[model samples]
Target chain A: MKAQKFWPWLIVTLGAAYFLIPLLATFIFSLRMRRNEYTFDAYVSVFSDPKFYATFGYSLSVGVFTIIVGIFVVVPAVYFVRLRMPWLRPFMEFVTLLPLVIPALVLVYGYVRLYGSSSLIPFTGSILGTDILLTCAYVMLAMPYMYRAVDNGMRTIDIGTLTEAAQIMGASQVQIIGNIILPNILVAILSGAFLTFAIVIGEFTIASLLNRPAFGPYLVGIGTNRAYEPAALAIISFIITWGAMGMINVLGRFAPRTSARTD
Target chain B: MPAFLEVQNLVKSFGTNTVVKGVNFAFAKGEFISLLGPSGCGKTTILRMIAGFERPTSGTIRVDGEDITHLKPNQRQLGMVFQAYALFPNMTVGENIAFGLKVAGMPAEQRRARVDEMLKLIGLLGFDKRYPYEMSGGQQQRVALARAIAPKPRLLLLDEPLSALDAKIRVSLREEIRAIQRDLGITTVFVTHDQEEAMSISDRIVVMNSGNIEQLGAAHDIYNRPATRFVATFVGQLNTLPAGVLAGTPGERAIRPELISLAPRPETDLTLTGTIADLHFLGSVQRLRVDIGGTLVNIDTFNNQTSPLQRGDTVTLHLAQKDLLTLGA
Candidate 1:
């Protein structure tokens, strides 16, 4: 019994140390911007910088767009497939997973190849077109997580009976989707949104290649130009991503259990 | 009187397999009809067709002279309760009950009052704030019932609403559902595989087999005068005895276990000597399996015999001519 307990404790301690040590070192180094005596000058500098506000705000809005697009694209596809065309699941799963197997750089390059200048649809010709292209890319990138989260959340409740119940009671299509489907899967959607937000905020390749001033490229710009502020930015980025993950975890606990599944 | 709900020539086919083959039935207003059948008998398919969930391949469904066969489910003004767990888990009991009323654009005060009335009808008047997951299965089902009827829909459809609960709750909830239906005077169509539940709750039962309705009548008629052997075997316990037991006839006889008695009476039409094969004590009734030469027949009698009869004991089984069933093929 003691030996069994020892192995898990040792494994957890090692795992925690492996992840926490680098973040702790970066945090400690970030506090040393003022030399011999420790200070929060690095963090203060990152906070007060005008570039930080512009890039962070831009990234935040882009993340929101990506999430909205993801919802509009994924929810209906999943709902329709699960309810009406269930045989399409295996094919849809493979399509959703393509984002994971195909690297981000390859996807962006393919986008550039297909929609570059002198092409039929020159998306990269204008800044707005480029932003739209980037948002679409992010939607594709986050498909795996968003699809699974929505599907799992949907699994916990019987949507078919609920839809039928609502419909027979004089609820139209919009009312059924808005009042019945959305509320039931709200937790899953939020979880997926937060995850997509975290991914978008720190994403560098697409935003940089598209010449957009996203926070990821700004972080790289700072890292290459300065020393201590880079650590501060890294810590801040870690906090934001961790906060999103924390929200996902906390919201997951509130989703109704499947024991009362009605179908 | 014109039938309030009329189903004419209803047929549904899924791909190559035909489920409901041109079935037709109609009931008057305030009638409680149950579609009773075994699994895969197209009973639920017919109910879904009526509810507008499944489109009939042919024929039309009319309610009060309005043809609603092509109408969407929402436009049909029907209240439906599913088998189990159809209550919205995210909403409270009050919200669930008031959902239809809210959708219908009822003012807040009226919706709240109607919700409270439904809660009171279901004996859960004070449970407005309770979410579905916080309640038991039976309570949640009752909330679903309240939700379905709060809109005072034109017709109420129940698709095996009490099949998920335990035996005790299933019985009591069904009784409560029947009483509530009577109180509201709503025309209701229920679907269930439990014949006893249908017999007790429905004004008339439609006994279905394969993809067709084998018999449709009151429970007493369905049991005593079954239209077919499928109805006889499906509705109740039936024992087939050789005709030789009835003073040497050619064909077999179908009789219910309880119709045959151990004690002979003045009106007893036939008496057969048989050896007691097995005895089953079913609380108020004891079922006996008797062997009369090569034929075996089941006999049920009152459980008044304190002394247990041995398997080899000779006993005389009594039957009445009126109790013998005439079933079609």
Candidate 2:
């Protein structure tokens, strides 16, 4: 009995150490920029660089844009499939999973080939068009996560009766979606949004191929020439991902609790 | 004058299967009627048609002389309480009750006052701020009721609203619902499969089977004078005896177990000899299965302080001639 309890705790401690050690090592390495002493020189050097602010800001804006486009595309498509065209659910699910099945590198390659400068819709012709193309690609890459989250959220509530009840109350279709459906699924949407933010912030393939100075390309550029500053950048990227996940956990508590109590 | 709610030649079919086969019924204003049937009997389908949730393949549903057959659910001005107590999880009790009023563009102050009135009507006066998750199922159902009726809809529909609750709460809440319906005097169409629930609350019970209404009458008439073999067997517990055994013409005879007695009495018109096959004590009454002439007949008698009859004992059972109902196949 003692061994049974001890084994689980030992395994959990080992797993925690396995994850935390890399982060700890990177943090200590980032502080060793000043010769023979620990200091915040690497962090200061990275923070003072104008490219750092420009690239990070660009990535943040792209992340937000990707989330907005993803919500507009996924929420209504999933909602309509669930409410009006339930027979098409399997097809929609299969489409969403295609992103996960087709890797990001291959997808970016297809975008380059199909939307090249000579194509009819030359999305890669101009820098602005390429950015838009990159944003669309990120939305596709995040499709599996976003769709599953919203679908699971929809499963918890009875969309049929809720829609009927709302209609009986004289709410228009837009009002029903805005006031009733959106609020009920806010947590799921936020969870998907945060996951998308984490995924797009340091994405490498599409942004690099598109020649955009996103944070992922910046981190790679630094890794080639600078040693301690790369470690500093890694620490910053880790914090951003950690912060997004933390926000999801905090906001999740506020979502409406399912009333399963029969007391 | 036209009836308040009239459904004419209502029919519904899904794919190749016909669920409701041209049902027709009407009710006056302020009438509490129940559509009672087993599952797949299309009772709920009929109720949904009336609520404008399901479009009837062929029918005309008129409310106060207005043809609402093709109207949308919002235009129907009908309220519905679902079997699952579908209270919106995001809203508080007061907000849920005020949803219809808010959507109708009622002013805020008036909406608040109306919501308070509905909350008081449902006996949840101080529960305006509580979310549905914090409340019990019975409480949530009351909130759902409040939310449905706050708009003062032209008609109210309850689809087995009490089927999910416990026995005690089901009984008490059903009575509360009946009392509220009486006080409001709103026309109501309730759907349920439980016969006792229908008999206890409805002014008229429409017993349906296989997409057709078997019988429609008051509780007493439906129970005492069932019009069909399906109605006789489905509405209550019944024992079927061969026509030859009852000395009747050439059809099956149906009799209620409670109508039979062990001892002969002045009102008794038919007598039979049988041996007791089994006895089941059911709190206030005892049910006995007797083998009479190779046929089994069940009889229910009040449980008295005297020692009960034992199994395998030969006994004489009595039944009035009027109690034996002859049914056609």
lDDT of model 1 at position B205? 93
DockQ in order: 0.55, 0.68
lDDT of 2 by residue, A4-42 (tens): 799899999999999999999999999999889999999
Clashing pairs in 1: none
Report the Cα lDDT for candidate 1: 0.90
Docking class for candidate 1: medium
Off by over 4 Å in 1: A1-6, A109-127, A258-263, B305-310
Clash count for candidate 2 is: 0
Candidate 2 lDDT for residue A237: 84
Per-candidate TM-score against the hidden true structure: 0.94, 0.93
Q: Give the TM-score of candidate 1.
A: 0.94
- Residue-level lDDT of model 2, residues B218-318, one tens digit each, is 99999999998898888889999886777644667779999999878889988888899999999899999999888999899999778778999999889
What's the DockQ of model 2? 0.68
